[model samples]
Target: MARWEEIENEAPEFAARVRSLFEAGTNKTIATLRKDGSPRISAIEAQFEDGEITFGMMQDSLKLRDLRRDPRLAMHCPTLEPPKENPESGPGDAKLAGLAVEVPAPPDTPHVGAGFFRVDIREVALTYVGTPADHLVIESWHTETGYRRKTRA
Candidate 1:
């Protein structure tokens, strides 16, 4: 398996983009099921560092209680949420898409761990199909496992 430092440190361009994406501090909405089987969701800050994703949960938050009973969690981030997008987009493509090349074949990233129990990115899919001007291009990034901040290095 490729070490986190090897991938992030050896490839400066890739490293730069990863840092930027995580640093962008895009809203991380985490949804987890409670012990009673109810749904719990919240918006918080998520970051990729060292070798995993990190998130903070307050002591009094219901999320914290749920985790104690059921540690599983999920995180969601969309490069292009809308099925149909306008020609005039935003400032950039998040640039994060470029770095997604870290994967060669499908499910390219195999070593994903429970690094974000605070949140998890379970799957990723990409699509680029449409007209020339108003074409729809979608590149999704995701992971399955999750972990907590304090426990991860």
Candidate 2:
């Protein structure tokens, strides 16, 4: 697992593209594990600060509870509909999977009494239509395997 900064250092262009996708929208989706080991999907807003990707939840929120119980999580950037006439023009979609490590809030933090966490990324991926719009393309980076790209019909 590595911090967001590590990804930037290792794969600058890929990291930039992924970060742009995340920043393009205000709300993102996160999946956490429930007590029964089921997946819980929730809306969230994350920030890139101090070389980390962090998010905060309201105090005592179920999502916070879920994170406390199980730190594993996956996050998806806001999805954009690809242009039917020119699918290659779309910005595409990005996703990341990682472990959420709890962090201390700063003294003047806005989240006063909330839970905060930083992602220790396991893998990151971006999916989109290929240039000719004839196939789907997936670009991914993993902690152990590094970066790779795949295309499918």
Candidate 3:
């Protein structure tokens, strides 16, 4: 598991693109595990600051409960439709999978008494339509494999 800063250090350009996608909108999607081992999806707002991806949930919220029970989660950045005339011009969508490590909230924080966590990234990926828009392009980085790219027609 690695922090966001490590990815920036090792893959600067890729990290920048991923960050851009995440910052393109205020709402992101997050998937967590329910108590019964089912998947739960929630809308969340994430912050990229101090070299960490941080998020907070309302006190005793279901998502917060899910995180407390099972920290493993996947987050998807807000996405936009690719241009029909030039799909390659789109910035693409980003996703990350990781364990959420609980952290102490700072003084006078906006989310007072809420649950706070920082991601320990296991994988990060960007998916986009390649030139000609005939195939999908996936660029990914993993803790074990580092960086790789794949395409699907």
Candidate that would win on TM-score: 2
**Candidate 3 global TM-score:** 0.95
Can you tell me which runs of candidate 3 are displaced by over 4 Å? 110-112
Model 2: lDDT to the true structure: 0.93
Give lDDT for model 3: 0.93
- What is the overall TM-score of model 1 with all chains considered together? 0.47
Task: Write down the TM-score of every candidate.
Answer: 0.47, 0.96, 0.95
Cα displacement (angstroms), candidate 3, residue 121, comes to 0.3
Model 1 over residues 92-122: C-alpha lDDT tens digits?
A: 2332211111112225534333122322323
lDDT digits (tens) for residues 1-153 of candidate 2: 989999899889989999999999989999999999999999999989989999989988999999999999999999888888999999999999999999898678777679989999999999989988999999999999998989999
lDDT of 3 by residue, 39-93 (tens): 9999999989999999989988999999999999999999787777888888899
Residue 141 shift from truth in candidate 1, angstroms: 6.5
Local lDDT at 149 for model 3? 88
Output the lDDT of residue 21, model 3: 94
